[model samples]
Target: MNTRDAKEILLLYRGTTDDSDPQFCAALDYAKSDPELGQWLREQTKCYDTIRTKLRGIEPPLGLSEKIVRSRPIPFPRIWSRVLQLAAAIVISASVTVLLMKWSERRNHSVAGAQEILVTGEVLDMTCYIAYNLSGPDHAECARVCIRNGLPVGIKAQDGKVYLLSGEPGHSVNAELADYAAKTVTIKGRQSVRDGFAQLQVEEIRKL
Candidate 1:
């Protein structure tokens, strides 16, 4: 398979635990021989590791599981019990997949030989914009909340293309641009495109 194909499949990969899945195994093998894809996979794996670490640190409320069990109105038949167990497993899997997609934040890199360019567009809170086509004045407040809470931000150009926004190394542009969500703005930055993903490392931003 090609690098793009491998990347699309690997996005669902849940680290080494998914090693036994044939699709994931094939993607992993392709990634190994491709330097750029390998680097991306490593980054994605690191992001997943960070999420896992944070999840492990969370402590559920005491007696929560017991309370939930007790709150059940009636015990189910064996078949119903099996169905409920299967449902729960499906829910957990779906939740993990959503989390994986939502939190796969890319690190800002200083691209050598990248030239500065100016782009004018409406600021965007990427998650909702990408998932639901949510944008414009009505969605601005929600966009601000999402961006302030660490979701990635972008700018949708007049031609309808979106460029993800970033900041200097070790800094995130989310905080600085949260207030600008859905507003027309102009940004001066260095643009980098890899694997069809475009990111703008903002040097200056001003509302239009």
Candidate 2:
């Protein structure tokens, strides 16, 4: 299978499933031999682990929820009412922890450079591009609007590959991208991926 197909399949992969499925095995083997793909897999796994940890962390403290609902001989007095309040606090704390974990993930994803490579494609707002399966001049205006509203910008290469343009803490796409949105351009950059997200840290860009 092609890398893209492999990526799509592996995205939904579950660890509990057999590792011997031919297609998945092909993808897994390919990832082992391909640096970029391998890095993507590792990052994807990290993201998955993070999600699992967050979900497990939110599992209410043992018997907390059950106690809240369990029938009792008497209506909860103020002393018993404190248990309900404690449960609320536990939920709130769990929520805050999840938020902090997400913040930490984002912070850890700060984009970095890899080997420089040149690619040609149409600049796009990634979200709309994916949602609408669009490219070229007709979509530029919409792409521009999406980017301005804080959506990611990327290039969908002629080969049907997408390189997300993101970096630093704020973002990588600059005011200069306004002119290129949905327009074909050749760009040179050091590409990098973290948490299965790929990005191009542009060093040069010009209209094709």
Candidate 3:
């Protein structure tokens, strides 16, 4: 084989290239007549010898061979049975672990879903203008109104006229109302609203 072909054969033998029966046979034939190819093959053989020598120097795990030899003779039937048993155990364990993880994730999600607070009363009152006179005030209704108006879930009316609300704590409602009138509200910030009659205005609301 030429240098390129010879190199390809060597690579294939070294597992760097895929195996091909025709290429392998052709390489063997070419090596007999080509001096350069013969030398390359010899070098590859030397590399393999070096690798084998290194591997031989590595100690096997303690008593592995001894234990294998000392173990009872494994008949075909018993060997197959043991293999099946091992496979079954592995499959069962993997399935159980996967099921447990799914169950745990579901349980955690359920608990988190349950713990999520629905904004109600004064908390809802401070985020938007509430014009509804609905008696059965619920989160669903609040969400609907807020979503429809692109308003924050900061306002709710238990009775009487709609009140402008905000989550700004310790801030006067009058100050917020003034800010709202100016249209100088910020769309992003943290604030707290203490209670009703205290007009707290949110200058901004931003998605978290």
Candidate 4:
């Protein structure tokens, strides 16, 4: 089987309850008939068995059961009366601060020659591109293209590629994109324009 087909079969084997089904039994029989496929299946089965055995041995900490059963029911007033009031005030103040900061940042970035736009779509796989127009044909124009296509907040262009910056604490795409956009930046490969949108190809997506 091809790599993609193998991957799909492996995924199905991991997720489904059809191991005893006729089709699956036939596939297993076919795999066993081939030396390489037999070895691969054996390895996968060993791994799955090891993981299952390890998981089966796991148990909750000693006293966790007693602690849960003995927990006291807290009175509503004693539980959240003061905490809720304080938390509400804090949330309101924090929300106002965040809104003001966002507004200020938006204005400052706009005046500083950076623009922002939203790119919304369900990313199909971990490898996808943020296509943009480069027909204006200049490096600055490319930068502008990056900015106008969701760059100002944290995305940037480097070596003609658009990079989504890590918001804080590290240099990596946030976890939200970890399962969609493979890398922080995507290199522009082949591009074309159709229906008023520039389509740029992204390459080199593989699990690290």
Q: Which candidate is the best by lDDT?
A: 1
Q: 87-124, model 4: which lDDT tens digit per residue?
A: 55435433432443243233311112223333333221
Global CA lDDT of candidate 1, please?
A: 0.72
| Candidate 2 structure quality by residue, lDDT tens digits, 1-208 | 7777666566544443537777678788877887877776665554344434444455667876567667554466756765675455445533433443343336435345367789898887664455435556755665565455334578888898888775445544546676788788898877776556566777788876
Task: State each model's CA lDDT, in order.
Answer: 0.72, 0.61, 0.38, 0.35
**Distance from true location, Cα of 135 in model 1, Å:** 0.3
Off by over 4 Å in 2: 1-113, 167-171
lDDT ranking from best candidate downward: 1, 2, 3, 4
- With a 3 Å backbone cut-off (N, CA, C), the pairs that clash in candidate 4 are 126-180
Q: Which regions of candidate 4 deviate over 4 angstroms?
A: 1-7, 11-18, 63-208
lDDT (tens digit, per residue) of candidate 3 on 119-200: 2233231221222222223333333332222222233323433323433333333323321221212232222322233222
> Which pairs of residues clash in candidate 1, taking residues 3 or more apart in a chain or in different chains?
none
Cα error, candidate 1, residue 177 (Å): 0.5
TM-score for every candidate vs. truth?
0.52, 0.45, 0.26, 0.28
Model 4 quality (TM-score): 0.28
Give the per-residue lDDT of model 1 (tens digit) for 1-208: 8987787677566678889988788889998899978877775665445434544566879987567668974466656865685455435533543553344344445576788889999998775666546689877776776666555789998888898888887788878898998899999999888546687889999888
Q: What is the number of backbone collisions in each predicted candidate, taken in the order shown? A: 0, 0, 23, 1
